[model samples]
Target: MNWRRLQAVMVKELRQMRRDRITLAMIVAIPVMQLLLFGYAINTNLRDLTAGIADQANTAGSRALVMDIVATTVVTPTLAAETPQQLMEAMRRGEISIGIVIPPDFERRRIEGRERVQILVDGSDNAVQSAAAQLAQMPLDAPVRTGPAIERAISVVAFYNPERRSAVNIVPGLIGVILTMTMVLFTGVAIVRERERGNMELLIATPVSSAELMIGKVLPYVAIGLVQTSVVLALGLWLFQVPLNGSVLHVYIAAMLLIVANLTLGLLISTRAQSQFQAMQMTFFIFLPSILLSGFMFPFAGMPRPVQWLAEVLPLTHFLRLIRGVMLRGASLWELWVDVLALLAFTVAMMTLAISRFRKRLD
Candidate 1:
């Protein structure tokens, strides 16, 4: 069986593996990252969901019931309203996932033994809707009693996406996912390939500075990213029937910012990676968390505080909010300035890192 030859070959391979520091690091890092991200960050049991309270009753009983709902920890009331109309508007704007409307006669009806309280849910996000439904059932089976005379009856309503269609929530997120995946991979490989082909040294010998070289590499990808965004949006709208309720200009601006951020990230990775394979591995490492912790597949609020903090730093996390806000809620750029600024900051930071890391001379 040539056992000696096989052992020699195995030893040679292990020596090569040890020399490739990036690959070695990936071997140790990817599994640990997967364990932490999936075990700690990915959660389906939704909690601390943003909710609105429309307390028309304005009575002690209504207030007590709201407190009870909050105590359950299933939803956290963040907005207050005087009527159901306001609550519905909040849900439509993606401000809250759950809305409680205590009618004017709610206290009277409860005392009379026929209390009805409306619970409105944003059905676009299936996970939030499912968790809300389960929580709503808790009060329905046995109403929350504020006093001996008060007994509540819950009427649950699913808004925006009454059908709880997965497509409605996923299509908008897919735009960010596609852009991140394509932009990062394309530019990361492009720069690495240039280095591998000795083109980087040729360019370095010329008058081109590192910053100029980086900009030259990234500029073409910006055009490519825009074309990709347009095609994806067009297809998503036509095939999935994804609604774009906001100004298309906002979407375009957000998309461009997201694209630049990812492209710069690719350039940064390429600067650190010696080979295209290492660049791809780096991209995958970033891409995994982007998909999992960015609230693309799961509810962002469901994750723990530490995990949410990690998510906040991810470019995809902010872009997802921007895309969903514009497409689902008709949110204006002014309303989403925080997310817009986050993306802008990411773009600038990544570009700066890439430029500073890229050396004109080969090591």
Candidate 2:
């Protein structure tokens, strides 16, 4: 090959790249996005986990113990629970990660060398479970008789997964992660593929409106999403022995919401993308952050406030909570209605955007 011909072709390709703003933007944006996500957003050390406190003794000793625990910064006591029942309720609602309970006979039990403090942990998340375990092992210093400090005894009790099995947590989250990976990717290329394959004319020749066409295009993929969900759940139950303590119906309902939300988002990206490559880039743009920030691989309670707010916007984040609540905690959909509502709202918004932006006429 001639050097001149190779240089000429390279220049032609560079010109084409300059004209494609989305591709250009992605080249710059993705690295910065990754840097920000890894540097600031993603945290695995697990700090500031939301905690609830039930100080029954209400004495100086009980308060000092509580202070010592908080000083460790492994968990932050954000809720004031009057009783252990209230603490369980908060953990049940996903409001707190763990509960700190000081018994009424805390000091008395200390004298008798019995357990005084109980740490109730939401064990659905392995990271949070690890944090709870770390907190349990912490030796909080309290002057027993004004001499050298005596170590405070903390008892740890895990709520959902007593065994703390990795599969128990990973399998449920894998459902959401798989759907987000497939459903968005499949439909992200759907409309663009039509244009690339010269099917736009056939579609436009039909009497269907843009909204009708968009809905029809995504319907088949919805079934595919469910099939994937069933396969994962079945394997989880069969191989991993993952528990289905809650209603399977609740799991399906939650899965359906997430499936539709992801499909709509893919369609939205399809409308904006000029080609299958552009669509894939945009899908990755959404997919990467969803995986990182949606509590799929990390504890939601451990993230900073801004990161948590950003995570709350992702469909997977809410779905993770819903699926885990149903499959592990035996929680009904009604009990986790807040996350359900967020998913519903996301699906509707993405649907509206995809339809309104999609033009029946070719670009």
Which model scores highest in lDDT? Answer: 2
Candidate 2, residues 17-76, lDDT tens digits: the string is 999999999999999999998888888888888899999999887787788778778888
Model 2: residues with Cα > 4 Å off, grouped in runs: 140-152
* Model 1 per-residue lDDT tens digits across residues 205-293: 79988888888888898888889889988998899888888899989898898999999999999888889999999999999999999
Which residue window of length 10 is worst by lDDT in model 1?
143-152
Task: Give the clashing pairs for model 1.
Answer: none
lDDT of each: 0.84, 0.89
Q: RMSD to native for every prediction?
A: 2.4, 2.0
**TM-score against native, each model:** 0.92, 0.95
